[model samples]
Target: MQPFDAKPLSDGDEQLLAALLDGMEAGLCAFDRDGVITHWNSEAVRILGWSADDAVGRRGFSGWAARTADAHDVQTRLLGAMDAPGRQVHEFALLTKDGHRVLVRTQSAAVQGQDGRPAGVYCAFSEVHAQIDLERSIALSEALFDDASWGVVLIDADLRPAVVNAHAARLLRTGRDTLLGRPLGDLLEQGLEELETALQHVLAEGSPPVPSELWLSLRGDESAKRHCWRSGFVRLGSPLGEEPVPLGVGWLFLDVTEAKLAEQEGSLLRFRHNQLHRAGRTASECEDPVEAATTYLDFALAGFADHALVDLAGDDGRLVRAASTPEGSSGPCLPVPVGTIPVAYGAAHPVLQAVERIGTVRASFGALAAAEPASRARIDEWAAARRWPEGTVHGLSTVLRSRGRTLGAVTFLRGAGRRLFDRSDAAYAEDVAVRVAAALDLAQQLG
Candidate 1:
């Protein structure tokens, strides 16, 4: 590569200097120590509506560029930069060639001579409104990265975090320096593919018009389910290029997890309540009370769980599996034979726990997250040992009571794909158990 200063003025250096000055985004002009204009670029002419031929060689903006009264003070302040130790800034109202007034902000500095003394002053200026706009942009950026409540991150074109603001770092549960350059997969347990796809789309086609909601599982926490975020993106491009060059993506997001959970809980509650109402209407038509009891279980399994069982306490103090959902699934629970043997439940099983405590008992899979092939095999063995249907990972067993007597227990089962039953789920299950216990009590009285 050739250096910029490889050529002297005799060899086209003067033309190069002129080209550099004219290509600048800001207006430029130079004056001699006596305050006579010696140079003016095209931008300077564009700003004041004066061509170089008319602006250069002018002894100062006395009658043409400025009001005669203000011109003297403007000239004194501008020229004083020649003796000033550093660049000096001033605001002046100058006249354009069309007789219109323009207020400009300028920075003036002394131009050194060959003998290292101040020979002249060179000033660069822009419209005052434009200067204020630039300052406002800088201030907004500082505030967003420092004090904004939500997360803000700059994702480079490579899709790694280039800059993470303080709020973003805290949300990510790491320091700003630690998050930089880390791949999205390392930070997210799930949803990494979806997030990277969105970023790639922004780099190729620009930001989407509408915001997106993503459910993300971050790596640091294991007890939590997926978190919800309402995110907006802006595609950043280089302003200096003739054609827009993609720089990165600006990602802003607010944590909407609590709101999202509340919304889901409300929807689920309405659904479960509706299912209970529907079950009551349907069960009233059944001639046999045992069939009515199982009908309630079928309705409850619609969204509540994968499978269920009803075990009734026998006269011998043993529990018999009197009703259960079909092995394949989605079918109604069927009644077992009258003389069927008792279920082989151990002393400490969740169903037994519910009967012993006369309350709901919840149990987790006790399996690792991100289950590998070996871990999955172990889970299968664990499920088989518990005698639950193939993939059961969660259980909520509630005691069944009719009047003042503890009649039996009803257990709701969930597969590996579902979340563990929470307090709300236990409450719903107990509600279903109450209806089933009433039907069972009626069947015994009729028999």
Candidate 2:
């Protein structure tokens, strides 16, 4: 009911300013020469529980005081600065309109008249001091969600979608627009069955959430089983600045498919490689090259092959088959000609080319057919005898080449479709070839 104005308060202006201050959420008041309340605003009344009519002329420090346990001396220090007018501004607290105390910052200064005489002290109070104390807490919460390595989603207290970050969007394979405001249950169905289970566990447990590995079939397609994720859930504080309680749950999902695949492949490779190493070690202990070659062939056969032939190279562009599993191993160099032995086309012909090339080569039956008509016919004949699909056999050949000369070829015959050799498998095969090449070189030296 008063007009607002700048300094040197008019009765109408003071009344209007008082009305505006009362309307503000922040508290405002002034003190006279005796450090007594001369003006009080409605916010002061609401916050400190003091009516302007009752507070006027009352000792500001004695009759009206606001304090919190955290800042006990703030009000005392502000009022004590009245004697030292040099300190233009001071901050403190006042008793709220209610008996309750709150943290507040006050700007107080001596009010001087035009003649330069000290007339009173004016103080404006604000409540943003509490917000400063909460900054670190807010930052910690943000870090929990943003820095998480897994995909995280926040569901509000009402069970509505509050927020889902980039990771969650990718895991769910949906845009933020499609995810937000939707129920967590609905989204979980569209995402992964594992996600729904995790959600239910969080709701039922009502405790700190747990971690789980989930395989998703959200796409309902051939690729559905490929979608696997590891997830975690934790109850979190509200994003609103209110006093925090567990108002929502955070769900984090991490893609573990690659890690799992790598683990499996590594295990297999290690198993096969270990077998090769053990065989070599055993043969060396016995000082038998023939036994070592037999052992190596067995190990090689265990990898995508039913049979293997480890042979020394002859000057005649043929193999001297030293050892073969199932016995009666023949080659052109031995009683049985290696050139006459039947090989299924494309079944691991790469091993031969690799041996011939003195490097690594990967080939299909077609590649083998292209290499030699006689070799192709031999493979076709074997395929027909086995009553197997011709395409099921691939011939891989790796040359035992050491110091750039072809020492021999360690050949493998892979049965079809049990396992398609990947690049890693090929690389491992190359490594075995190199080792065999070294072994051949050493054998020749011993001879």
Candidate 3:
């Protein structure tokens, strides 16, 4: 094999190399085998406040770049890398041109010659504090993605999930890779509009002063259960850009569904208690016992349901409608004049079931079919067969009992727009039934 011959670098080549080294972000300096400085880049000059003309011919850092007491050790460590393998890391306290001390971290590597011998060494360095700050930022980012208790998601500028942490992936009920780049609507069954609005607001107007709580439903669940998230958002921008340029948004959230539900339940309970108290006060002033019974029904409808009906047990095991809200729309409960008139409610009706079992009974039309026209006809027929008012989709019947005896049943009806009756609704209806039963028992005794 022929030995390769290398030509010396042209003046243009040297100038180009010098410009490249001068433009580097890290300070760079090269030393010869004889311990003379051969090259000093612009970053090194800027850090030490010395010109390349003065630095390139200096033998070592002693007496100028470093304190005399520390210079010998620093120079020995820097020069030691010339004979060592790979790179060597070291920290040194160096003197700037203005005599201020600056601590720096340096990485030194041996520069090999064509004969496979160490020709010199080159060192790259940056301020120790700056390097430490960079390391801390990287550590924080890693911790957020790996070990955070709350959910963390990095959403791109287009509002798609770019990165999802483990906590966030679990909340989304998906793998991290599956959520990436997918639209927010694809993951959430509802509340996408509100989420996107919040993300866009963060990108355009910066973060809001307070974190927001969002209620959303998940896809592919039969219950269609809703969840509440206490979410915070921050807009990420490009640090390298001259002006603030939006990169994406960072979202952190925690599942607050149970807490929020408890809060709402407490508030609802308080309001219902107040309503019951108010109804008792107003009913006491009524001239007729039946009027007071209707007053209880009117107050119970405030935030519980759209309409209410009170039926009283009549002769031959039949029930008669005693009072009810308006049939066309929501209104105060009025006493029905159907005296001794037994309603044609079948045996299997929810209201009749409640009376027979002495417990609350709940029923709904169940999810409507996709076909609108046919589904509408089916719903109407379903409502009519049960003698419910128009648009009633959900019904709750609580048995009206007074002193261990069943008086009748009171039914609460909700329109198609409202949610189905759950256990909480049953409990509230039972509370109202207690009040209604007392007033009706009094009416029966007085009549």
Candidate 4:
């Protein structure tokens, strides 16, 4: 058997070990088999206001460091770890040198000797509140990554995803592991600049009081569906640093696309309804019913379409242009020239389809409108064949009906830069068509 003094650690090694123990964030102390204090680190001094010189040579935490009534029980529990298989946890009310009482939670493990016999016990401890705070932080992180309803993401300073929660991963349409360390630009087809700018602002200025909305397009899809997300951000800074040093950003977002769209649709419908009411009131003042019908068409054009054409069913069952917005520039709806020829619309035209079915008909150039030069030429020919104005790329034709009889059909046109008309737009156009149809029917009755 080797003697304890035969191969004792060198002074330098002892100093290094002491330095390592002192640098730890936790308070550490060790006791020998005989219950004599053998080690005391700087954290212990900082916690209990006891110097190493005073703490190292003491027996168990009795008289000075613990209540006289509780010292014996606390010592017994700490020393019990020497015979325990693993670490034993306990809480003790410890007394600082200044006579302040601090409740501490401790984990004590047995240290073994050369013969595998229990030689001593080492206990690491911290203030109870600090220990509970650490546990709370870990639990919160786990909950967010596993079961949160909204998307939660941790983005590092380099603007890359560091940690992504399940909800966020699903929203991004990718696996959590696949998104980590990837730039946001790779995931978004548009609005990357706005997102980055918002992130930078959070890192520099801290969190904003209210959540912000961001609309973005996803990559690798041609449907061009844009999504709205209501997002909040918090700047994370290192707790250990003296000055606030940016660690990353915590981003939380909820999908609000449906809600936002509903709000916009409701607002637009209200505006259109108000316009209709105003147009009706203004039209009643005009003595000429034809002029009143044009006034109705003019009011319908605001924020609805770039151009609109009103056709009347002629005696030959063909459509003749009654009123139209001027081409090449914006203008008021004017009656067509007297004795003008009817529009040369073919059988399969959108206007003809609406007239035949007495319902709304939607048409567009489709992919050809956005295609190369050759396909663009085809678009021009397609519009010309329908007798539509040049540069028209999208169209919606709604049948006009009044007094249970089809009055005519009104066609709305959008240029190449505008979006293709959707069902909602068709609905709004139908509402406008009702007013225009009544006005046109009155004109026919008056004439």
Give each model's whole-structure lDDT: 0.87, 0.59, 0.87, 0.87
Q: State residue 125's C-alpha deviation in candidate 2, in Å.
A: 13
Expressed as tens digits, the lDDT of each residue in 275-319 for candidate 3 is: 989999999999888888888888889978898989989866679
Model 4, span 1-447: residue lDDT tens = 111222587788777887889998999988888778888889999999998888886889888889898899989999999999898999999999999999999999988887778888889999999999999999999999999999999999999999999999999889999999999998987778999999999988998899999998787657767899999999999888789899889999999999999999899889988988999999999988778878887888888778889898987777889888888777888888655477888878899899999999999887435322245577678778877777788899999999999988999987776778888889888987888888889888977
Candidate 1 Cα lDDT to native:
0.87
After superposing candidate 1 on the true structure, give the runs of residues whose Cα lies further than 4 Å from its correct spot.
Answer: 1-8, 220-225, 367-377
User: Model 1 compared with the native: what TM-score?
Assistant: 0.94
Residue pairs whose backbone atoms clash in candidate 1: none
Model 3 has how many clashing residue pairs? Answer: 0
- Model 1 / residue 72 / CA error / Å: 0.8
lDDT per residue for candidate 2 within 309-347, as digits (tens), equals: 566666665556644444223222111234544334243
Runs of candidate 3 exceeding 4 Å displacement: 1-19, 113-116, 367-374
Worst 10-residue stretch by lDDT in candidate 3?
367-376
Per residue, candidate 1 scores C-alpha lDDT tens digits across 1-447 of 112213335547777888898997778888888888888889888899998898888889999999999999999999999888899999999999999999999999998876677778889999999999999999999999999998999999989999889998988888999999989888887777888999999999999999999888888676645778889999999998899889999999989999998999999999999999999999999999999999999999998889898899999877888888876665778898876588888668899899999999998775443232236677677667766787777888999999999998998888776777889999999999999999999999998
lDDT of 3: 0.87
Candidate 2 has an lDDT of: 0.59
Q: For candidate 2, which ten residues in a row score worst on lDDT?
A: 327-336
